[model samples]
Target chain A: MSVIYQRVALIGLGHIASSMFWGMKASGLADEVTGYARSAETRETAREIGLCDRVCDSAADAVEGADLVVLCVPVGAMGAVARDIAPHLKPGATISDVGSVKRAVIEAVEPHLPESVHFVPAHPLAGTEQSGPASGFAELFHNRWCLLTPARADATEVAKLRRFWKGLGSKVDEMDADRHDLVLAVTSHAPHLIAYTMVGVADDLQRVTENEVIQFSATGFRDFTRIAASDPTMWRDVFLSNKDATLEILGRFTEELFALQRAIRQGDGDHLHDYFTRTRAIRRGIIEAGQDTDAPNFGRGAHSTGRAE
Target chain B: MSVIYQRVALIGLGHIASSMFWGMKASGLADEVTGYARSAETRETAREIGLCDRVCDSAADAVEGADLVVLCVPVGAMGAVARDIAPHLKPGATISDVGSVKRAVIEAVEPHLPESVHFVPAHPLAGTEQSGPASGFAELFHNRWCLLTPARADATEVAKLRRFWKGLGSKVDEMDADRHDLVLAVTSHAPHLIAYTMVGVADDLQRVTENEVIQFSATGFRDFTRIAASDPTMWRDVFLSNKDATLEILGRFTEELFALQRAIRQGDGDHLHDYFTRTRAIRRGIIEAGQDTDAPNFGRGAHSTGRAE
Candidate 1:
């Protein structure tokens, strides 16, 4: 429960930033938190909701005299936000970001940051279909993995930042920016794209009828619908920023899908059985590795559990 | 709580059958429920666990003198089961099935049923990734949808069967057999196939490493793993039985996926944004239509409010 930082500046008041603000306050990890958002309405909502100790008028104002400045914007906006606040960042301050794609973010933000500040690119692989400041809660980070890709960061500064995330109740791991993006593309981006695609297909079906889709969705399509409900702006930026890795994963996905389609068309029951059986084992491995909870956990709310949907 | 039938027969003692056994018994909808499984081990388990009042050695024996007979096997096994029980079915008995694909099931089963029996093809859109007798619970069907495709049958029998499902806490809808298959292919089969395919893709990635797939799965691929963990035999039969509809939906899915891929590869942010936005609205529509619960329900174990992971 020890305070990790005296003053923390949150450069965006979206789901991640608001969750971090509440988490830091609830854990007593930060003595003071200042928040800023691109829209006046969001900044006002952040202040009114008491998500931060103070809601600043601008990103520069939020970072002034702060010990830590964390950018939590869409990936496409990282460079502009970084440049906008660079002049106001305190000397020797540690700066970080919670963006889904890391390599692009590091490339976008590092050059704009002054050498006096420590830049650590991080991604907390935790979210819900809901977005914005109103959707965040204090326990969103509990027991979730936070990947940190610190480029040439000082040892002491890196340790301090790691402790900051750990204090927020996250298990931390370190990886290179490019590797992080690649892993995420396989794990998150490709799956999300698939969900979007399947839901779109269902929505576009003129013959099936929408009522039937809604009534009988409990089978499997409902899962895709849940995933497809994620914030549009954030995901749009993710696909834009991590184009190479996302495209690579999508290619592999489409190839496997085509093979499965052929198997189905040929009535190759054994091939379908083998593929399904192998994938079942992978799910068991995920459960055994403590990466996901078992099937019964599908009714729990976001803040109450660390398991991903 | 009135008993709708004096005796009910369950032809397969798997997840759905076992769940129905418990659900009917718990709701006091049937005075006597009998069960039969092809394997002696399963029959013994049913007896030991008291999954049914009587455990018959054969499907024909189970159906004899029963007012209702429920086929709960894989779709591929339904025709044979119907033929095996046809001679033993009580005169004027109501026969129904719980299969994923309706049109193929009716085709497979109707030929073998006696003209005196009323055939109602049903699909309860409720199940977990787990299967077998041990995986079922009494509350598994609560708040779920049950779709029934009754042929030109006795109205009294259809109403009685609908009441039986209602007694188990399911809202019932009736549709034509061919239309039911097409609707489910879009809403259920295709989504499951996509899930299986993506999980397979992740499993095939040699460079990423299994541990990485497990550790970083929170990104998106983990959701598909859960769905892919479903019973392989049941799913294989689903695709095999409903081949035409599934292939048709899969074709549409692939075309849409390719379009999205081209957009991403071309770095067309607007295209990604518009598509993602449209999909998000569909998800919202699903939530509003009451097909999905809005609560983030992915981590809570059964019988506990705590999130599982």
Candidate 2:
């Protein structure tokens, strides 16, 4: 396939940024790829690792003449990044992001963007527990869904960006920014919060159990541990930026959990069984829906390829 | 390696039972393996798939001359299975089970066992999100930990069983039944319950949003779905059987989760960040302790090898 963008600038050299760098490079979909991170050390690492064609000293400098500039920083940092780069953005350049929450991102970055630039907030629902420039792979986005919440903009620009993600092996879908946030709250945000909570519960119990939690964690808690092990700063910003929807989902989660607790306390086996069975069907639906692999490799000391250590 | 048991009988032809049959046969740890499930269809499947050396007609018939009789049925069925086969068990045979809750299995099975027979309760903390006779393979037990909760058993028999599991590529550990239940309550039982609750909450959301929950589940709710998708009968029996420990852990989990909810509601970003950071450390411990794998394959549609599909 021919290159889609003459020049693409990645404004954050983190996991998502680096992965996009590798993916775009591997697919040969961009004529030139430049990258910029806030930290000098990260920029040095990116250059040393050959993660970009040009490693720039500043976000504004990186996007000076680029057709596409992707903001890949933590959600809380979007406004500052947008403000810093708005003055240098090329006219008609399509500006997008890889933030987890869409509504907050648009609200934070839109006011700072130049009217000549197009802002499309997108989230590729693919990641590993690992983060950092060295942790990304070209195949990270393969077969994953990329949700785009576009503001009022040129249809051609949005379509071009969607094709960029599609070339990187992602299935693209578009929705309103508010609906995207609410959907993510149920799917990703609430689940992450619960994982964090359960891991905290296990950690607190470590004092009483004396590390037995880690030793025998092959059970269900091990799954939470994997999810909770994700980068703390990114998650903190995720919850903070997506506060309303996250809190709403958490309210529903707590209400359901309380009902389960009451059922357990009352020795209500039927209630437990019914709830468990219903949830089991949803798992089947997920599997049938092709959302998850049907594997129980939670705590097994093997990589995804099933190779044992 | 020599065969540890002259004849081994599996009382259920489900995932665990079929896996054990394949594992033992693959390792040459059992001279002959016989199995019986409640359904004739399962028995036919066992025979068709070559999951056992002999697909027996009755549980009693299967255990008549076995040197080791393993109860692989759901926890609620253990008492009945033990009672049915108690009269047919060999005088010096070792009777054990592969149940999730040790104390309950011991209580249910020990009462029905003859004094001449050795009764040991074991829980292999390995499984997949699939079930039935067709969903098993030889490598299911490889590198997995198998806990033997021996109750007044002869040291010779316990050693032999441990060797058998070791031959099948499992690391064996011994603990008291009560402690096993509590340890598992935190590690396995409470996690499954929480997963069930979260997935149920997602399912119960209005129909318009439930579809989004599945599509965007790659975030964190997807992990819960995998855990919640496990066998309903097995999990239900686990909660009902290990009521005390499960309830205790659930209480602790709810308290921790409520504290988190309060933190989020009040927009206590510090509390959220601290908790998220601490949980990340727990996941690090799990990785360092050699309890879990460290690769991200959340969206990869791979199947657990030994799971019966």
Candidate 3:
């Protein structure tokens, strides 16, 4: 884990940024790490937690001498942060982002970046429901996928950035920005919206008291809550920015849901059973791929013992 | 921890029955436990694993001389299991069930039970995605809720059954059968149907390769897969048996989902943020009530060590 970047600037002090800071320190991936956040309180918390070697008061100041600058803000705010920091970015610096949506972020931030700097929009496909400057650890990116969408970038710059993420213990892969949005819409965005809708439905049901829903949630609804409780602003922007893809996936979801509902109404047990059986293969595939564990109940007990909040 | 029943008969050696046997044995709540499954292979597994003191060949044989006969079969099969065991139960014996649906189970089972026996329908608000005798453990019911819906049973019989569940490390409460069905429809049945439909949609998406979906499932779809991978036979029966309540919840879910989808389409950030904030409160309630841990990532790391899959 030698230094991959002599100086790295993290332009948003949130979960991804703070985790990148700790991970870089843990792996010696950066000689010096500087961080900045728009909120005074977040910057103060970063200072208190020793989140970075230099907690810069301004985003421009943070990227002044850095060879790498990463925008770690929400999708909707990435443009403003990019514009604010563009003027101060060093020549030959590789500017990336950790936003969930790639196409929208690239469109928003690309115009503001200097032609001299290499802009490679990236997203690390790892996170928890928790956010903020304090809710990060060095292992957040370990063995996780980091999708890098380098738009006609220099090969040497792309490889260096790949090595930096690899140093943080991630498997780096390249994808087109449009394809990334569509894939994420299927994998993350639509699923989250569906979870949120389910939770909201349970809350709106008057017959089943909220107390009962929470008390008996272990059966299945608890998982929906975990996904629905994710950072609101980040998810809001994701759905808004990736509207067409999210809506398309969601439309398919509704159509499929209606089909299943008809099967239930028609008492088609075979249809339900066959559908359920087929989905189990995908779960097995996920486990075999090492993306998810196959312990019963998602292995909550092992992780929630002494360290759970 | 005293013996609540001299002999307890488990009429199906599946997850619930085996867990009950182990929990009862762990707490010394039953002098002897007898188990029987329709499948001879399951009986052999039970005997090999010492899941019960005696693994009987027939439900009638298992229920003989037992003061407590608990039907642990699917809801659709409860009536047949009840009729098979009724003639073999002791005069003052108590008959119970662990079916997820209550009203249909009561309708199916109550007529089959002898007048001398007490019919108490119960649903344990606990389970893992895994099934079968091998998946059972002594701590599966620890601190979980087990709802009992007694139909005009003697107070002594109901009290005894409650104590028996308490001995198994579950918090027991009584509710009307119809109300139990409604509450479960909101909490478990509907959420499961939604999870199943989402997983099925993910599988059916031709553009998104199955490998890609499996690899990127850590985002949100993985949780849906874990739930959708639950015992197909049991879930199919649940949906069919509890059709009315489940359909009701699904209707409400569709309505709420449409509202959220509209908000996303209209670029209504305020609507999305408000709804997300409200759902966060319910998650907090679940954590405070000890139904779920507040750990990030739903504590997947805790239970998903080397033992995953």
Return whichever of 2 and 3 wins on TM-score. Answer: 3
**Range of the 10 consecutive residues with the lowest summed lDDT in candidate 2 chain B:** B300-309
Tell me the tens digit of each residue's lDDT in model 2 across A146-165: 99998687899999999999
Candidate 3 achieves a global lDDT of 0.85
Per-residue lDDT over A112-157 for candidate 3, one digit per residue giving the tens place of the 0 to 100 score: 9889999988989888777899988888787788999997989899
Query: Which wins on lDDT, candidate 1 or candidate 2?
Result: 1
In model 1, state the lDDT of residue A123: 92
Minimum summed lDDT over a 10-residue window in model 3 chain A is located at A300-309
Chain A TM-score compared with the true chain A, each model in order: 0.96, 0.95, 0.96
Expressed as tens digits, the lDDT of each residue in B1-309 for candidate 3 is 788999999998888888899899899999999989999999999989889999989888899999999999988899888877778889999999899999999988888888888888888887887788998888778888899999799899999999999998889988998888888888788988888888888888888888888776655777778788788899899999999999999999899989988999999999999998888888778878887665554424536421111
Better of 1 and 2 by TM-score: 1
Off by over 4 Å in 1: A295-309, B300-309
**What fraction of the true interface does each of the listed models get right, in terms of native contacts kept?**
0.60, 0.64, 0.61
